[model samples]
Target chain A: MIIQKPGIAGTLESSDAQVTVEPGDGKIEFELESAVINQYGLQIRKITYDTLKRLGIDNVKIKIVDKGALDCTLKARIEGAVYRSCNQYNDLPWGGAIQ
Target chain B: MKNPNMKRLRRTMMFLNAQKPGLIKDPYIYKPDSIMLDLEDAVAENQKDAARFSLYHALKEIDYHGVERVIRINGLDTPYWQEDIRCAVAGGCDAIRIPKTESALDIHLVEEKVLAAEKEFGRPEGSTLLMAAIESARGVMKALDICDASERLFGIALSGGDYTKDLQTHITGTGIELMGARQNLIIAARAAGKQCFDKVYTNLNDTEGFRKDVETIHLMGFDGKSIINPRQIRIVHEIFTPSQKDIAFSEKVVKEIDSKKAQGIGVFTVDGKMIDIAFYDGAKRTIELAKASGVYKGEL
Candidate 1:
């Protein structure tokens, strides 16, 4: 369930955020660029980190490009990318997975 | 979400594509009586999962604030419908709209999945509801059985495009091609004591034609119409509102009917028009319609 060849998730459209994940240096390093940086930068980063935590990934280089996505859309896109990167397509716990 | 009411005002149920975050996010702002998050014809085959994710979130997060939330799932004939139900239930949508439904089995099959999803998601059993889209000649013919198939069914909607295609006829503004099917479906819905919605008017640009169709369907005894755009909402609601004279006379009849029944008068006359117990329900319903349409300020 560890980072399998750097998974990416999310979209770059307005009200959506795009995230790219890769193997990290034994620590969670987060990078974010958002049109609403002055207002919602921290909120975007927090959503990305929380999604990663729920998916049980402790360390990864996560890049997020935000177009002002709502919390749920951001969460889904990140979750999609993580699952896609790990090649775990079947039996996704769509609502939320067990830790 | 408000608790499911078998009889609710759904004069305009607008369809929003499930995958579009922007559209699904705040369609309630337009104030359609119901918002149908579509996972069937609107979604691309490859994007079903993505659409489900978006749909689940929209249901969970959007505070539609008294607007009925209906999920239009893929047909029972597809592999995607079961999962679609799970997502809809988990997200707590008010009802499931089954597309391409032709028989009672379609309702029963989806009802079983809905019940299973309710249990799996810890939702109250029988909390979710269902309605069918009569899309073909077979569906039109079997509309009665379909409407009576389950108690979860609140109504049946006429899906005109598929129905017309099945008849192999072009849709003229006259609506003659669909007259029989429409009449048969409405009669079936009425016989089952269920609400029926007219088919959508697809010509977005034809306001004149849309107005005529709405007038025709409204007079055909449909409870409502499946409106595709916001521009159509006000007109449908306006047309469906009981007129001042109709509402005033209905109120009088409803009140007099109550007193007459107590006096054991089985029949009477109001304004020289014959009145009886049979007209009581229709009169009460007109008052209800007037109140719902914001046209009645009278104390009924």
Candidate 2:
């Protein structure tokens, strides 16, 4: 997904994938570009956003340029970026989102 | 450049305990001499940007209790490395652990990027330290030059797992194949008057084995071991501390050296070995360890 709305329930869309938000307690939207859309398009897109949701982050917008990243690499990069953006400083109450 | 005497380096236990979000909340509470809030391997790829943001916020928010803070950014070979360095330095990290450094040029390139980051962040020049993780054979070979390439270069580390993989060596706790690399890195770091650290022991269930490995590395002259589990911290601390007898002997050497100097003697014999200025250097190091470890609280 290239763009995601900033709210509890949002729409996610990508070149090869789309998911409807359940409007549940905790859900987030993350979107990114795949440098190698033919090789790692679906898996990279799914994992980048799935990780944030798993971490209980209710809302996010991710833009990934995947250069043939595998499942592991996709997960690593998304987690790295999310943590960095949220952890620019140590005083925020971003406790449950950061490890 | 902020504080020259701050070079009295502490043996740093950089913790890598980020499993769940709250799992690593109070990294400083663990009392690691350094905290490496990892954003590379421990994090997944798609989450790279988010993790970077999280790290930036964490560093800005968390009170790390004077513990030295570092960020293990992705390798320079990756697309994420530049942004990682930029955000890490801008967020006030003391050092950036450059991964997969295979040559002096790799370190030089990273140094340039870090210098730019420093300037961009308007940080004091030379406020950040560059720690190169030599994870390949080439990195080991060029370690000395890498260490000497920049004054901002604080130390080098031996990442055992990747090095073993790069060398196509079998993995085991024995670390037999890594012995040569470990020893060489220590020699290289010491030759450059810099610090060197051993890699993390991944076997969390094998605490005894981990302790033994820490002892081996400590005996081999490593400054410290990168610990993956908090359970392993005490083992590393124990291994790095000088024993009571060793501390006493070091104290005796210092006292004897003082008396001899007072009597106009330049040297003396300890246990039939020639004890000269060189011996005093070792004795002084032992005393410093004792002081740092809180074993020698008296005034020097």
* Candidate 1 TM-score, C-alpha based: 0.92
**In order, what DockQ does each candidate have?**
0.44, 0.08
Q: What is the lDDT of every predicted structure here?
A: 0.85, 0.68
TM-score of chain B of 2: 0.92
**TM-scores, in order shown?**
0.92, 0.74
Model 2: residues >4 Å from true position, as ranges? A1-99, B2-12, B15-20, B266-274
Worst 10-residue lDDT window, candidate 1 chain B: B1-10
Tens-place lDDT per residue, model 1, B79-163, is: 7888889889988989999999999999999999899888888899878989899999999989999999999999999898888
Error of 2 at A97 (Å): 20
Candidate 1, residues A1-99: lDDT per residue as tens digits? 477777665556677667788878998898888878889888887877778888889878888888878888877677766776787654566566621
Q: Chain B TM-score of all predictions, in order?
A: 0.95, 0.92
